[model samples]
Target: MQLHELEEFRLHAYENAKLYKKKTKRWHDKHIVSLTFEPGQLVLLFNLRLKLFPRKLQSKWSGLFEVVRMTQHGAMELKNKDKSSTFLVNGQRVKHYLRNDVDRELEALTLNDE
Candidate 1:
């Protein structure tokens, strides 16, 4: 009788764990934003190296790299602006580089007023 009770409890616990895992996965997937890039697009690459001493104001991302090639496995080949250097990086570590269009627009407006 005691063995039957233990087996039932184990089964219940297993089901609860599976449900929890499914729920957690669903929640995580819901929050993840899908990112994609095209060849010739500019992007910034995230630096993963830990510095000996971190500066509070230093920017961690470094790039204005052009996407030279894209792989099916979520990797990208990036080239320097001058085309002198190239490297392959995971897409997860790169983000689209946003230009300061607003500032340029403001400057244009000011010039028109002048």
Candidate 2:
């Protein structure tokens, strides 16, 4: 009787392992997301330094710019806000900022109407 119980436990463990493997494989086969950029687009540059840059320069998380050139397949060349310098950046380093641009434009238009 004890031997039969041990065999049943082993079988249960084997079935659970097979189910876990199937679930893991399903997760591994899931698709990943992708992003792309084009020239003349504006983007925010990511600064690795937790310390902030001077206000006249790029603030740690606030630097924004235009895409002056596309470098390697997934990289880009970005011109600084003042157009003084250009930087090469990987796709992972950039984030789209169109909403900010529209907000600024609307503010400018409203001010001009005043």
- lDDT (10s digit) by residue, model 2, range 81-106: 88688878787778887653444433
Q: What's the distance in Å from true for residue 82, model 2?
A: 1.0
lDDT of 2 at 57: 63
User: What lDDT would each prediction earn against the true structure?
Assistant: 0.91, 0.76
lDDT of 1 by residue, 1-114 (tens): 999999999999999999999999999999999898888899998989989999999998996899999999999999989767898999999999988776443343434554
Total colliding residue pairs, candidate 2: 0
lDDT of 1: 0.91
Q: Provide the global lDDT of candidate 2 against the true structure.
A: 0.76
| Candidate that would win on TM-score | 1
CA displacement after TM-score superposition, residue 11 of candidate 1 (Å): 1.1
